[model samples]
Target: MIAAVSGGSKDPQAGGGDGREPITAAAVAAQVGGVLVGDGSIEVRGIAPLDRAGPNELSFLSHLRYGQWFATSRAGVVLISPELAELAGTPSTRIVVAKPVDAMVALLARFHRKEPRAQGVHSSAVIANDVRLGEGVTIDPFVVIGEGVVIGDGSWISAHAMIGAGSVLGRDVRVHSTAVVYPFTELGDRVTLHAGARVGREGFGFVPQANGVVRIPHAGRCILEHDVEVGANSCIDRGSVDDTIIGAGTKIDNLVQIAHNVRVGRGCFLASQAGVAGSTRIGDGVQIGGQVGIGGHVTIGAKANLAGGAGVIGNVPAGETWSGYPARAHRDHLRASAAIARLAKIVRPLEQLVSKPFSSSDGESRANSRADSRADSAPDESGT
Candidate 1:
């Protein structure tokens, strides 16, 4: 177990005790090739939200909604896109970039801990016989490598991770703390498995037999191509016959569940808690929002985006954005929502009209009778 650092320390700079030179905003701007619009010599100790940043903190502006805060933020420096540079006003230094959020992400990675493993393998690690390890591999404490496992060069396996027999990990791959890769799973170069990620797990396949329901044997593999990253606690099940494949540059967020025989294409982004049922084929550049559930045997075409909480039951064509429970087109869903809202406004009036004791003609007659009665009740001083 990794020892927890005590938070009781009063010193703000206590986190960095190595005596290394502190990173300044100018240094970050230089690294990302962004031009500094204000004082480049200012030293920013930490990064914070735009609204909560202090004098020693760095904040970012990427959206128009935060433009108001950017003008008044106490941050020492602000990273902003070229489009939002005017909003920063005077005084505050701005690092202008084409993509401010991406630049901010690069800066965060530079400041944060990049790798969990120490420089070398731990003393308590267990390596099985006939395991092949490449150069510059770092295995943390209590990690277990099964027999015939092959780890490529420049890979880092975090503490307490288990690599099953005959599994192959490519170069520069990172298996985070407590993550498990089952036997026969293959990972391409630069793959990242976050903490508690499970690869090549048994699929939910069952066959109803005469006597009882029998679990189907998962005899296939799970393959993650280059640059694939599995988020924390996400699970990728092994195939029933063929390999369940995750294409290059695919990113899956936390709590995602990918069932057996699912084929995910290149550059796909699956958000948190998104689930793809068995045998679903997701095309390239598809974006799945958080908590979206795709039914089994479905096919989502390239560039299709499913909005949050969408339930997809059928096939989706290319370049469409869908949302809502049944998952219709985004514009159609918005139109339906607007229609419902308008209906809500008129519903009370319709209800009152339907429940009224008198019709329109009866109302007119009553109005005329009241007018005649008021005339009769009036004084006859002006009468002929």
Candidate 2:
């Protein structure tokens, strides 16, 4: 047991500094200084969590709560904090460090290196007159840039992407393959549009008229602030009148739909398949889980957490956690669910009490019928 081990025993080794090379425990220690308690020559190929790590994977014991699972891990090497190293019982080669989590992050990046794209316009790319491409902007093959589009410096527009007229993309923006940006849209710096994402589509708004249902004209533009990332196939609609604004530092996962006139605050995290209806307002730092749906005209306060699969029809206050259909507070939903479960036990006894009288009457009727049949069979006693 490592319970009594001192800090003096920490064997700091350099971690994997060379990019894309399958390094051993010695290399890991060489890159990031940490104490090596086991075989430094063990070769590690990948990084993973403690529960899912294989024999060739490197894992980390970051939180003390996960120490229980560490005893049964099968990783080839593990990074652990000095204080918890003695308590951990994994058979894997242990690297006792000052911060296991930070070391893991550095090692994870080393394992996954990015492929650099060429910084220039492709030969087959089409550009309209008056389209402004800043210095070092890379346009991939078959990209269509519409008239009056302005792309900032160091931006990369991938293959087959369409930037509509009057759209402005800020510095260092990345529009992935097959993404579409409609007319009059504005994208801020360092924004990422993943594969097949759509921006500035017309909102679903109609007015009932005497002749027929008239489609509301979407006149306003869609705007995304700096450091925002939209996942694959996600869509953001243009506002009916006012601009649709997605605040800075927000991440929207795949298949998300943000309707027209929606205003999302900064640092919000919206998960995959989550949708916000038109004119809804989401506050800062809110966390919306996967498959959550917020109704039109609803306002979600700051720091509110909507659990996965929640359906919200009303407003949510700040810092509240909501769940379930027609979403309510998570704690209340749990309590109500528990109460409903208890009702099953309570209803069974009442049903038995209500049915007891009829059961007794049925038993009496059967007994009388048997007696009558016996009397009828005894006619020989009467000497007929």
Candidate 3:
């Protein structure tokens, strides 16, 4: 029942100039243990979204909100959750699995193969005499290594990356292109600093003097524990007195800002555009949604979840969910939102009643006019 969905010649073996191997649906089923609902012999060359998948591409449907895409998608082959396979009654091949997104990720690793980089220092890299580079370190073009810096073995410093003086990076670390590592910063093994990530920058700390604000010197370092991954364009500031620490296995999303003296615990996931102000302590396994702003000196307990755009001004208890601006408990937020919605209905009628003016020829107005005339005829401040 499998059919080609796109307006292209079926070429499952097709690939770009790189060495990405094509895989058949039978192989994919064997790899991810998905139940094939159609022909298993069809070959899939690449992976993409449902709308953008070509004839030889494998697509996925995970979120129900994207069902419109599924209803109209022309993907040649698709992966669906086992529970939703009946909803996808298309002519294309379907692989039913428990998690469609996870399967698609696996297919991505297969199709978009990483290019092998050579292990050596590029000629354009500037290395100081006191710099210690371990075996198998790959320094790309124009990389600047300062004095007394130690880069561990099997690490890759990409093009234009600057490792400042007295910084230490552990084994298998990857500092991507244009990433800046400030002095005295410490990164553990397998840490990844993605493109344009600024580590150990000066924190935002100032004192109000008689004349103006005086800037405090950022003296302490920033420590990213083992297996940490900082996304592109994120900034981790150095502490004013104590170290700003990112615990092991934490993955930060793009455009995040971790301020001075903030301690983020292990395995925490911070979504894109999230910010933690200075001196905040986030417990382990906390999940922070996109664009969430955490105030300074707040402590979030372990496994707490902060929803998107939440402004957390105080401590959050462990295993609780917080939402809304100036975040509160999840149930409280829900009740408050419901109350506001109900009040909106009640307020609309009152607003209309207040806006309407009194009738021009009303009986009440006539009575008031007669009373004013009587008062004018009867009374005066002085005897006439």
Highest lDDT against the true fold, candidate: 2
Once fitted onto the true fold, the runs of candidate 2 whose alpha carbons sit more than 4 angstroms away are 1-57, 63-76, 82-84, 87-92, 347-384
- Which candidate has the highest TM-score of all? 3
Q: Which lDDT value does model 3 have at 108?
A: 72
| Model 2 root mean square deviation, Cα atoms | 12.4
lDDT of 3 by residue, 49-107 (tens): 77766767788887788787888786767889877787843536888899988887776
RMSD of 3: 9.3
List TM-score per model, in order. Answer: 0.81, 0.79, 0.82
lDDT of 1 by residue, 204-265 (tens): 99999999999999998999999999999999999998779999999999999999999999
Best of the two (1, 2) by lDDT: 2
Q: Indicate the TM-score of model 3.
A: 0.82
lDDT of 2 by residue, 283-378 (tens): 999999999999999999999999999999999999999999889999998999899899989898999888776677888999999999999888
Model 2: number of backbone collisions: 18
Candidate 2 yields a Cα-based lDDT of 0.89
